[model samples]
Target: MIDVKQPPYSAVGDGVTDDTQAIQNAINAAQAGEVIMLSSGKYLCGPLVGRSDRPLLLTGTVGAQIIAKPNTRTLLTIRCSASNVFQLEFVGAALTSVQPFLASSCIRVNDGLSGVVIQECKVSQFSGAAIIANASISLRVMNCDMSTGQLCVQAARARNIVLERNTFHDLGQSGFALHGDGIIIRDNVCYRAGPVGGFGAVQAGSKNILITGNHSTDGGGGFELQNENALSATEPSGSSCVVAGNSFTRTFAAGIDLFRSGVVLTGNVFNDCNFAAGLPTAFTVQPGIVPDLAGPGSGYQAGDILTLGGGVFTRPARFVLNAPSPNGGLCDPARPATNGNTYVIDMGDYSVFPTNPANVTGGHGTGGKVIYTNANIKARGSGYKSGDVLRGSTGTSRFPVLVRVNIIDANGAVLEAEILFGGYYTGTLPTEMAFAAYDTVSSGSGFTLLPCFGNRYAMQYSKPSMASGGSILGIGNRNVIVSGNSIVNHSPSHDCGILFVNFLNAPVSRWAITGNVFGTFSKGAIKRYNFGTLSYDTAWGAG
Candidate 1:
């Protein structure tokens, strides 16, 4: 028989007492098959522990409430298996806490638990997940009214979980961020899960999962599944996921985003979701967000996608590699200059004096990136390798922007590295963002050459320059299908609906990209590199 009753537990239910010890006492006293009932009132307290041995069922009425202390862990922790918590309001003290956002959880289910049920509860204002399943198995969060938290439910390294009949609204990140296998997320509704841009309403990186009959309205994206090699351990590459019968509305991003292969997305309603970046398609097998290509632009923020303006995998025009002298001035003349590659300079002094006033934005601090353009002492070698100084000078001052070799124009001499100044760079070494100085265009030589040649054979200044073919693609990835979605609006700031990029040198195979609907895109539907030529495919929503 379960010893179920109120009081004697010292739980006043007064709504204004520190009932931490009293509630803990009740949880401790419960034996196997026993339950503790709370009366109608608020129990302001700290963390509570549930045990697997006693298997306590902590039940509360509609008026019963449990609140976490400000700036602390979750209010309820259930690591023990077969533990059940029901019908209680879990409130986070975000209003009365000092920096509550740092580390706080409403409920956390630690690893190695089984058959844990959290049902019919209300969780609000938590800085972290309302329920986070960390390496736990067989956990069920059903019929819960969860709202106003950072990630309402997160399942990382957990398995065989079911989240159903949950109403999540005004969340901070994702309604559900899952990272496990054999998980089922159904009959869940999320409303503008967050205020700003984020991931999916139900996001994950695992296989054998089914996301069906779930509804979400604008927060970040609708549903995203990525093969994040860095996050997963068992299956680094994602596969065997089924996302169907889900409804999305104006999600501010793609309605369904899948970075893995063989993801079957059918019978999904994407209403105004693919409207992000003015795309008309509701499903994506690649990254749907337009990359933040680095160029002469301002107001850049962190996490912005930086890309080479027109270069990724082409035979980049090599910088003249006479090789820097031991003293850092002109190259050692013993080695001749390569005609097409050598960037010869008429140097008076190889001294680097910090005479230019430049500033870069969107880094560690305001203007932390040192900015430099063309200047005196302007001779540099292009024979790049593991052992090479990108920028060397006679004086103590160093070059501003390094690593970023924004070679402009075609095969011409005399570098005008001023293009590097127009970009916001972030790196460790001082020579990371700095570009070597050169002459201007009117000099019949102010040219932009291929700047990145980190690995090449000993040039002793051998190869002049390289003229070769390039490669681009309309889409990347393999064995994916995109069907039936709506995208009505697109941003005029960009020139595409969906731009596919290839970071790996792998081939794209067996891609069944078709049956997508596009609305108003700035430049047709999709654009990519076709061999060495820039090609545009009119398959806006479908490929």
Candidate 2:
């Protein structure tokens, strides 16, 4: 063992002196597998970089701290495989403002390093993440205490990382942001972590992940699994993850929010979660879309149907163009139709459109005819499934009245429909009787081919005073197994114990809900909106 205070290169342990060069010399001279020890005193240091070949162990006695100098981006950077750091406290400027430390961190492990271990360390008052591992494999962080930071740990593009037995509290943002594959997070405790609109205590967007046996209290939310990149992509951003045996209490938002696919949730417990009245339920699967705030692209005449692109799980929305008026003439002053501003007359049954301006036709008043018209379900047709295509008989071969089915009731009656290609027809449009299946639209881009599954979850005492929302809510999930679960004692104003909703005409189907215990909810035990092919033992109550 090489002691930093007792060597040829002596490091001052006093809190005021800079011991950066001394400690760095010791680290550089130390051989592989040797120990570099620091005795209980404050060592003010700048950034320290470790070698990849000479793997060393850095440990400290009680009350030993490494204080970062002002304006330090990262205090320690490790690129060595099998390096271990233990029992050292990392202290930062504790700046209240996040601007100075947005890119700063206490410790960072570079990419492609493996077998790095950080244990029994305490990190506090950093404006950014305490520990960041980028593409590092087999990294382990255990028994650490982290508090008062933007985030505790961020492992991105990494693999086989294990975070166990850690304690996080009072974070400005989330405790952990894990975006990788083969991650394991177990037995962690978080309190008062995650800010509003942030991804809860733990935000996981990884495949083959296991988040089990964690406890969270009074956080923004317990956990969130969102693969925002998966939207409009051919492959899911996250898949084959399991979140089980976790407990969450008094969360501001949902206890668990799933916006990814192929996740299996089981044996999770939620209590008094979703305290924010207008938020989602204890468990939710609400997929959201981020639209380009800028107005739809320029050019095009009245009645042009355009398909948008970009974004994950992007819904297919048909933007029907409206006649554009000149800026100064025949238009209200407040809402003038300026040059290059194309007005969308209708956004049919979808929320997000593409942001790429090149997809739009330019130069207004091309004199393209407007043939877009609303196709209503004049009569509720039976024996039709959601996503079924219907064609109008009055339409010519080129212009077929193509409508996509949106929602269907339990009795197989079509409840809603969206126009896919509203063909031009001179005669009156045909009714439901004249409609028949022509061809199904390609389930691409906006559809989630893989769905989330939930089984044996326990939810109770969620949103005690809230007049809306359910105990467990899901959207666009498929083949769910909600069996052997117990839901009880929800607020009287609560909507239901379990609720499932569809998104943008995508069907929620193949749910097997059996052997679940439900008690006193205001609306019912289970409710569904645009659901399909559900198998339940008991009748679902009113919503």
Candidate 3:
């Protein structure tokens, strides 16, 4: 457990007036966890100091106030040798020291440290970082309002840090600088900190992090994974990071910017941010000499499918889906879906198609009883010579019959027919029957039944199956349904069409694709990969 009591030499600072000297006296004599209790009053001070030799606790009454003079250094400076805790009401205290020669910070944890914990403090108005955790390990900062500083918390070279349930406001730099490894920053509200030309730049190059459930607004670039080229000489390997369920809106740039790899960006919201032209990507893989990875060639491999559900992107920007489909990259037979969510793609591209198409001449259509059946069946207006073999049958002949079918009469009065039937034979006897509409004898006369013309119609069992490539169905293993719950609008300036099953390069096995509406006003809808296992069959009818 914690050694909660101070050494015998520890002193107390009566907080009735200028408590700076009394607090310093306590710090000089005491070991860690020594409580410098303050009596209830207004204590004017430049900075209240503590040590990391052991843990220190500073306590005061509920109404006690420790006010720092303006333009002074940090209210509290945490050094490399001490791991202390400050429990007090700090008011108007600039956390950092102002003199250029002196170190300034509300709380500065210097390099080569092992552990420190800062909890349950109300610290505000530090000119520099409220809490600067530099090159340490296991820094646990929880339940603090670190506001009105140039940089709230500058975390560098730390590992296994937990920054939870803190509120940040009106800062200059990032809400929290995550330059450490294996950090968890969750359930924090950071607002109105950095939004100027040189405001709130996020820390660069840290790895194995999990950042989730945080809300940020009005900050310049919500969070960035900055890997400056100079610092990459000592480049920390950045991978296996997960950013999920965070919201970024009303920011100048990306919500969560990425400059590393193996980051699973799932279930986040990027809403109404100034992500217009030339803003950094919310998720970007920087260009470097490709590493010799074991499985995949590039950062993105084939057959890597993703499901984008339960998020919102309220700008007219591209939300990229990285699989191969027809025409674009969506060529897999396993049809994927964009459904079951209330996220709006108000004006952007949503179709996924592959880049190439494949050819297979050996696959023939399912044929009927004839030698070969073409798609065009009605031979009346189609070119057919006399004695053309419509269908072949071995049975004996039945007597011929006559019939007539037409859309209008020569007299122009609407023609009506009673019952007309013929050509009922059995035993595989192929017969042909054709009829035109019965014509009127004179103008506007009642229609009369004309003699059967020499027209020929074939009754046969031979019909070729339609090409499966053109068939888009959402049923069975395909599970493709375009329900009426979506609206897809494509601009006309760009050429577009829907090419299904572009995923042959990265084949899909089974899929449940339902409730997506695609509009192709200009550009194509779907494109599939050229050489992948992408097979897509749609059972749902297209709208």
Candidate 4:
């Protein structure tokens, strides 16, 4: 271990003298894996850089602090891999009024560094993020106390990052803003953080992420999933993630604002959350699909084949089948149909048609052939207006579906759908679909909306008396299991214990909401709009 106070490169830790060059010299001279120790006094320093080849350990005794001088952007920048910074206090100039350096950070890890650990440190009084990292891998930060910063930690394009057992308070923005994949945030506590924009204490967008055992009190919210980097299309943002075993209390916004896909939430608690009177909901789920407002256009007829287009990300083509016709011999004698019958057979509850016409045969009968001739609107896409024209694919196509919009709703949603041409489609539906004058591309990238497919177990919500929102609110989510939850002591003016709203009229299928207990809700235990294909059982009231 090399001590900074005793040597030819002596660092004067007197709280007033400039120790920038002395500290830099000690760090430069340290060999690989050697410990550079600092005693208990304050060391005034400007910007310092860690050696790339050394990977040295920087440690400090109790009450040891490195104070940033005026006009310093970053106190220390680490470019080395596998470096360790432990038990130090990073004080910035924002604590004082005169000559305060507002835009400063305590530490910054350069891009592509890996296996860096920062533990048991105190960081405070900076306008920018206390710790900033980009494009790093395997970074771990634990047992730290951070306060009085715009943000505690901000990371982007990083992977396999773990932040655990940290305490954050009095921040202007979120405690953590993380992006990329394989992130684990656990056992962190936040109080009075995320006040500026009402972002969650832990706001992240990543794939394969796990956020658990955290606590947030009197803050903006508990957790949110939103992409911080919009330009990176290849990165996974909020897909295949899990949020479980967290606590959120007395928050201004929802306890959890979930906007991504393929997420599982369970074993969490929201107590008195959404207490701010104007906020609508405690736990909110918003969909990412945008639909066109104008009605399906006028020029398309019943049998036309239309191609789908203009989504944020590319998806597999889907179509809805209608107006079935019977051909050949009768397949089922119980359900008799003539050869010219055009009425659609009741094909159970399935809405989407198979891609191949051969799969459309023998639903109610064995030998009778059923052909679906009419193509209809399965989903009305967004960003369309009245008078916009929709056309099918070109080139080797025989007849293309043609349509022009004529009517729209107050919010520009399509209300009337008319087909202008009855075109013939064979084999399978074409994969190309486009619109003229109504195509709007997605504004941001790294967002793809998939169905929610997971199990929720034993969550608790209690005492949101200041707002008129549901304890749990979901919009446009599917394939979820909500079981063994308890919602108690809600305000009488609130809507319901749980509420779901589906504006797009998409199929809300495969949802199992069961074994939930509710108490003293004004509306009921649960309420929904445009709900589709659900199993609701084993639910009761406590009082």
Higher-ranked by lDDT: 2 or 4: 2
Q: What range of 10 consecutive residues in model 2 has the weakest lDDT sum?
A: 449-458
Candidates 1 and 3, the one with greater TM-score: 1
Order the candidates by lDDT, highest first: 2, 4, 1, 3
What TM-score does each of the candidates earn? 0.59, 0.61, 0.46, 0.58
Q: How far out, in Å, is residue 352 in model 2?
A: 35
Q: Assess each prediction's global lDDT (C-alpha) against the native.
A: 0.48, 0.57, 0.39, 0.54
Q: What is the descending TM-score order?
A: 2, 1, 4, 3
Candidate 1 runs further than 4 Å off: 1-5, 96-100, 195-205, 228-239, 274-475, 484-501, 504-508, 513-543
TM-score: which candidate is best? 2
Clash numbers, per candidate:
22, 6, 90, 17
Kindly list the per-residue Cα lDDT of model 1 for residues 1-543, writing each as its tens digit.
222235566676565778888888888887777778876787878888877565658888778888766556778878578888889898776332111234367887778788889999999766567887878788899999986435778778878889998998655446777777777889988865542223343333577778889888754556656554311222335447777777777554456544455556666665555333332211110001111111123333333222211222232111122322232222222222111111212111113322222222221212121112222213323422221112321122211222112232243332322111111111221222223333221223221222221101112211111111000011234565545544344345334334443323423344444565555455555544232233433443332
User: Per-residue lDDT for 306-343 in model 2, tens only?
Assistant: 54333232234234444433331111122211111222
Q: Residue 96 of candidate 4: its Cα lDDT?
A: 26
Off by over 4 Å in 4: 95-102, 197-205, 227-239, 278-467, 471-475, 485-493, 497-511, 516-519, 525-543
